[model samples]
Target: MTHNSIRVHYGKRVVAALFGLAVAWGTPVALAEPVDAANQYLGVWNYDQPDRADATDIATVGQFGINPLTFPQVGTIEFTRGRDGEIIGHTDQGCTWHFRVNGDALDLTSTDQYCFNNVIGSGYNTYSWHVTVRDGREQEVVRANSYLGYGTFDFELTNGKRTRADAAGPGDAARLFTGTWMFDPTNPAYLNNLTSPGYQPKTGAVRIDSNGTGLIARTDDGCTWTLDARGNTAELAPAGQTCARSDGTVTMAFWSMSSDGTHVYTVLNSTDPQLGSYFIGSGSLTRQP
Candidate 1:
């Protein structure tokens, strides 16, 4: 099908026509590229360059070091269904790539380079990635167009151990926090009503630690919190700020996940009368690799 025709059919349902005469039994429907191979790479894969290459030195890889063929700057890659239902990847740094299964190999290329160039320092350069699944772990090869001309370097994409998310059974709220998480407790909005004039929202990563007891969360500014219990709540003291006449001080409380696993609901009581008292708000959280 033409690319334009495919784009037009995006998100549209294709109805199956049943055959009455012959029963086609046990044949699985063919799945589009990356989606079929999603299990091969959806989770985290530790990344490393053999002797520490330029890609590793320049880009931001995630905690588990996703994009092992690239850098160690710790970043994340999230997979979702595209308009055509193909596997689409979105990263924490704001880059998007698409994968297509070629024979027994999974091939992918960067479709969007926004974060790649901005955060990763890799410009419009498109690197072709071919990953082959082995008995235990998969092997990856990354080749730049420049390298293709000489036919010399197939910079081996570092392949590492892959880890999948833990299963938390049905109806468990803790499951929501099971994946990686972060939050910003220092948001100026956390300050009590008296000290600050308005409300500021906190930001950062949010995750439930392996022990299943600690809540690891952080903000964009790097302020971090590790909650030790399941139901405990704590008020945040704003980290001193350089913004207003005083160091930003925030007075906010944080509660654990509710039973349904949907929101990070919180109440912020600002010191500034103009901003009002006891502001209630909530944020939606998604699972991260």
Candidate 2:
């Protein structure tokens, strides 16, 4: 081939290789995965007290007895991992740390030691961040060492109350409460695996007025209840026999919803208390005519 023709062919091959490289690199940049829109930080996160064998062990698990907890002391422990497999955590108290995965949960120890490295040697001071994510949110109750006994430790993630989920007076509370709700009377059973001795699994409906002050709830067994803007813990009383043919009355208190209004949770203290006292419950409800 002529020298000029050889030079031109070589130049063309270089341009083609560069073009292919650009397309290969640019495709991934153009089609990156969408960020997860779920703000896991928004909803309430609860964990039960871990069943520790002793007080010293409890300290190791990082439990301080029944006082107001700080973000570091209490609240969700956000986990962050690095590309190199290093791990870190952020908690409500604004504290950050290196963590190790102990099974399904996290163990937040001092930054000095490594998780896999410590599996065989001397023990160090550390706290357990035993938690589970449910419904895309972390549960507050965590088991520090083992799951055995209960502790008096309970926490609210709203920081110091009046969270966006809290009753923002009548206006906001009403807007949130006004919705169409279908009761899956079986949900609690599904979670706890316990059934009431006499009650059948029946469904129901609830309608909240826009004024944020009225409620009309009906049971599938043919019972109803009406509500007016009244108290913090409103009684979910049955209107009459037509409303509830069942054995006991239903009561609800501390009603609240997430910022997105997609999920609703309440502290329902049933006379029967289906699962137990202080039943923390949730349901899927949406706005409607």
Candidate 3:
């Protein structure tokens, strides 16, 4: 299957603008205390590099490719303040990390030892996260040194203006999908393997207003799209371009929000002969706070 690059010019512009604003605002205050930086880490963060293992060839060396020891290749990491004042880090894959801010960085250790062993590895492994707020956006750098190997991941997240999951009401469903959603390029579940080398996930957002009409933004190759919402389902399509499968069949994009509105299940199905008769891209999106 021949893959076409989606122009991501819009996302680039937004980042450039925000970076300028951050610079104009002067140097961000360096929080020497991890506890003091807790508030800065509160919110949902999307991975800047969705293809986790793509960072280095060694990443694909062993079971590492299929079994990553870090957060899912392409998903969201949500940080929230626990009732006890400890910071909680939640991954879309169902693992939770209890964070202790030690100044400039967070010391993360799994709360669910079982889930931790399953995703990361067995035995003791520690994760460190360093967060920096530029302008109004947040950037996180995570490093893990475990038996699997040492790896580092970076994330650049936009402020999605969302409340904590527990505080969200049912009515927020209509507005729940209104944030950035990314495709995991390395997740085999999200690609049509037979037809292409790999599908590059598009990074974008669903901007919904009170009036209910908004556009879907993709940052890969800068493709403009729009979205229509009805209840919990959102239908996405190219704004003015043609979206046809390899077999000449038209394609459509849609996403279904989970009941709690914290997760979004997405599907983009198309057809391609070499890539297979159908190209179905499936993944999850986490709401940003």
Candidate 4:
């Protein structure tokens, strides 16, 4: 869909933005050290780029015109903790990028001259990458997308690998989040920044379905949601087009779940890349029968 995207204009933050990431194209990952909220994303994430022998090309794609290609252009994403107590994000693609830790999930955006540009109609440009890590130690997914010209181009891949000599019965997801969960009005956790508030916390019920690997959930609203399960905690993100504010403002958010899986802390980080105006909000959620 063509966005009412301006060549250069950013709106203010309303709340807070990936995958559009389903099944990965998976690989064997050596077990990393036990991870926690403080440092769950402290390692290198590699994408399973397709080999030229395995590359596929198409014509009249995303309005960028027909061109020959093999695999999506993406590189490794690394996160390191600074000595002064800060998280740093780096990429091998040579794009100027920055990152944030919203709960256990990592958020990265690069809009530098070398990172993001508009050419959607001029001659499409797309560089998207996605990967999922499973069964080894960290069960996670990383997604990235860019469309420069024409209509949007979409890419998806699926593959699998089992590191354990034998298949384990199920994943932690089964035990952590299943069935229905409802938001608690009181004692809810939320992230609210700025002088005045512009939005309210999400209410109503949230339904979750897990298959031992990850979760697929839907909010009372028409939103597809996903959870990133760390060893003891889980992080939440929008799985598809998120609900918008009454004024048509949009948000990018990350919710943190309590270790017991009973309470969820919410943070709506409203940020505008162009307009430079932003707001933040916080709230809480609890489990239900």
Each candidate's TM vs. the true structure? 0.35, 0.31, 0.34, 0.34
Give the better candidate number (2 or 4) by TM-score.
Answer: 4
Candidates' C-alpha lDDT: 0.38, 0.36, 0.43, 0.39
Q: What total of clashing residue pairs does each candidate reach?
A: 36, 16, 9, 25
> Per-residue alpha-carbon lDDT of model 3 for 127-217, expressed as tens digits?
4455555554545544443343344322222212222332333345456555555433435533312222245443445433334453354
**What's the C-alpha lDDT at position 216 in model 4?**
67
Q: What is the per-residue lDDT of model 4 for residues 91-173, given as tens digits with 9 covering 90 to 100?
A: 43323334445554444333221244211112222232222333333222222233533344432232311122122233543
Name the better of 1 and 4 by lDDT. 4
- As for lDDT, the candidate ahead, 1 or 3, is 3
Candidate 4: regions farther than 4 A off: 1-170, 186-196, 199-201, 236-256, 269-281
Among these predictions, the greatest lDDT belongs to: 3
RMSD of each: 16.6, 16.4, 20.5, 25.5
Displacement of the residue 57 alpha carbon in candidate 1, Å: 12
User: Cα deviation in Å at residue 258, candidate 4?
Assistant: 3.8
